[model samples]
Target: MSALLGCGIVLLAGCGSMPVTGDVKAVDASQPGDSQVQVYAVAPREGAAPSEVVDGFLESMTSDDPDFRTTRKYLTEEAARTWKPSEGTTVLAKAPNRNGPSLHDKERRSTETSYRLTGEKVAAVDEESSYQPLAPTDYSQTLHLVRGNGADGKGEWRIDIVPDGLVLGQSDFKRLYRSVNKYYFASGRTNGQSALVADPVYVRNRTDPVTRMDTATQTVRTLLAGPTNWLRPVVDSRFPTGTALRKGVTSLAPDDQNVLKVPLNQKADKAGQGACRMMAAQVLFTLRDLTSARVEQVELESDRGRLCSLGADEAEEFASDNGSGAPDSQYFIDDKGRVLRIPGNTRGSGDPEPVTGPLGTGTVVMSAVGVARDEQHAAAVSANHQNLYVASMVADGELAGPAVTSRAKKAEDRLSRPSWDGRGDLWVADRDPDSRRLLRLANGEGKPQEVTVPSLDGGRIEEVRMSADGVRIALLLSKDGLMTLKIGRIERHGPESAPKVSVEDLRQAAPQLTDVTALSWSGRSRLVVVGKEDGGVQQVRYVQADGSTSSSGVLPGVNQVQAVAAADDELLPLMAETVDDGIVKLSPGDNWQTVLKGGMSLVYPG
Candidate 1:
């Protein structure tokens, strides 16, 4: 595994084989076409003093150019050619502190002054375009300014020394950069259906006139370049190794009919019709966020002829197989260890009923349980947390097979709540210090197969929840003694042979949050996270699958949140377990109503 350290977060990009082989077009420079043009802007205004020069340069780093060449004007001739903007970037929550114009040398009147920028670093992106969650910490950077003779022979400030990367405030960073997800194939299949995993990255937003089309071009270019450093290992892209738009074709704007024409080299023409469709699907999904409703189809063209075309309506067919609808019922585990169900639309009027199976008979003791997406199968952890059991939910059905034992020597370091994926696979983490691993059970029965997770270093997984799409997994982990929530991509290799599953590309969804106790998938692209920051009360908040918080307010009336669950129904019903073990339902307006008492391990189907 290869790793890139960011703040306190370490991103892992494991090595894996791309199972499918297909021809993809490479960018051809000889081809004639209308591509986006690049425009340069004037540099920052000249400053008279060292501090002013340093401040102006720092502010210019957030300019609208895809490259920081405009900002480079602040650097001296030597520094301009040596500076590397792609080295890495440090994202800060606020503007950096300006420390001093201290003299570089004490003898005589020093001609050089050094100014230091200090602030709280929130995240970092490496040269490979991998974004890592960073623990908030003081970050300091220094740039030396030299007094030099100007055009008129008067002294002017010029930055002679500085770091390679850029730094900007969180608000400015968010405004200037847009987050877009690239689609890749999941490790496993559901009902013989292939799934698409989402890999998100930040790009310059579409606010600049000179680089207005850069967003689409960069998004497509990055997708063709493959998943970011952290996700490169497990996931596979349909685009061939050399696949890309023709060299001069940077602007990929859609025509009047909302159709995008992506001309490629002849290699892409060799791809089979099916493979071509898959390639188009990847492009369609990645551009979906940027184009929104304007994009209706994508046509792949080569120097020879049109390879294939994919319509927005059929994108899901060739891309993700997560399904088109949501579940109609909410699910939970009662204090007595029975699986309970609540009609989503009925919210406050109905009494919860035990699921029809041995789980409802009160004969078994379960500490945690997960219902499959179909709601017909379930995997449960014993009250002791050392054993795992699988059972059917039919009326009067009994648990199947003996309980699976844990490898942990201590009882507390046992199995966590199991999660079911769209493929009907049950996943759980065994926290046994002696044999820490993630286990996947097929069809909720028998011994589990061990799956590889991102290099945790010393971190431990506390909970795991698979998205309804089975393309992502939400994890609450404890690293460096701090509880944090992260998202990891699931990659399955050699599907026809001995298929193997590995989790890689771990990134923070709520980097600003700590003491995350529990989390659950609330919607196709959203999660309900239960966590609190230092000196703050435990509360429930909604977050995107990528780890960004949603504007949806936190759940009310809870000092401590223990667990949460969301039904797939259109209304997106939600349930939470409080400190007292009472289950509360979140109303449409963020209102909370006690629905049941003595409820724990609340969960929805995979």
Candidate 2:
């Protein structure tokens, strides 16, 4: 009668874990105490596994005593019942012991072996450790994992693990790593080996492991050898996945490591909207390569009911690399917290150019950098801000975007920000040297509408705007410091004819000192003007066309202002203000409201 005693591996050739599909069951048929493993000397180990290994590593963090029984003959085996032995038995199925002498490897590795006193079927496995780092974080080190049978089987090797430190921070990864630290065969379904899609084109069996994209020829190469599959680059260069932090990421690799700066997924469909998405995601999981979670571990969990989707940490694989990269993986998600696959990500069949629908490109365009935001639909000036711009961000009191239109200048570049005019015409604002011009990109004559507001140097344009009725245009004027608001019935004036309103007494300066700056059209005749009070006390006043005004009271502490717009109606009535690059929304409340968050613009186009 043949009884299964224990099991373990001799590791004649293969380097780590069970074959991609082979059996890694820790089942050895050997008897108690006499089992031993024999590995041929193909190389010597340069790095040692660790002292006390698993239990010791975890025990330090807990109150329980965690010491392994060195003399017990219980081998970690299969068909036996459990993974960790029953706590008391020498029916001894032993895992391969990492004593000394191994292949040269810098990757953190653990070898688990299982075998009995007399057996042939050995179960063994080898695993590499992972890490994590804080954003703008960059760290690199060479780790050596040495393992063998007796006291002399040691080998040396090198492996690169970026984001290697991430695993170090996660309690889950550490738990998972130690649960099966000492490598054994078949980590079971949930615990089994995971395959990572290391590069952009590695999707089929026709290719091996180390696949390469030739920078020289722009061609791709695949590495083929024993057990063959390598994704090595022809010149070994990489492109950044998003916005590249030139100075920040330099520390991640040797000065020689090529910092990848691939054409941003949609570099400038409209977000920061010109250059590209930073090589690193400002949120989480910026870098996209093996150093991070590799393809298999970066899943974008979509939230179906919500506008934005949630992404899997360093665990789930991304479905594709189209519109949303990084954690914006979810086109949408279901209520169960599971990722609901979106349309473009067709089961990841590898579609390169997913068509861009009406939503502009799903690229990071202009992120609100100021402390101003509007209620879901706040009506903005309907003009692209160009006068105050360093970048398309509200740095001081300015906002900006790169020049993308035909009138673009290296300096005063003009990007077309087309806001519709209830009519089929597109409206755009251009800030020329002395002209605050508004253009109709499409006109009644089938040409772009170009309306330039004559310079305020002659007389300041306290406020210039199109009425909600779409029938008239109102240009509030405060020639000097006093407010001399004016109204114009633009539809009757024709496009080329400029509307001018003058109140002789209104143009004259006054000692009252109303330094009006921001204007909100509350109604065709009523307006909200924010300015200094009698003693420079900041206040927002509601002014009626009849020249009578109501006090909205002092604006509290905030003084700096760029743009302010009111929401359309009562139900969705909203207000937005640009503080810096951040847009803050003024939630309706008592007299005045303090800024509660960063920002997102909500323009009520209707």
TM-score of each: 0.80, 0.29
Candidate 1 residue lDDT tens string, 98-129? 67656644762346778677788888767654
lDDT of 2 by residue, 204-228 (tens): 1111111122211011111111011
The alpha-carbon deviation from the true structure for residue 514 of candidate 2, after best TM-score superposition, in angstroms, is 3.5
Q: RMSD of each candidate?
A: 11.5, 29.2
Score candidate 1 by lDDT.
0.70
What TM-score quantifies how close candidate 1 is to the native fold?
Answer: 0.80
Window of ten residues with lowest summed lDDT in model 2: 179-188
Q: Tell how far residue 375 is off in model 1, in angstroms.
A: 2.8
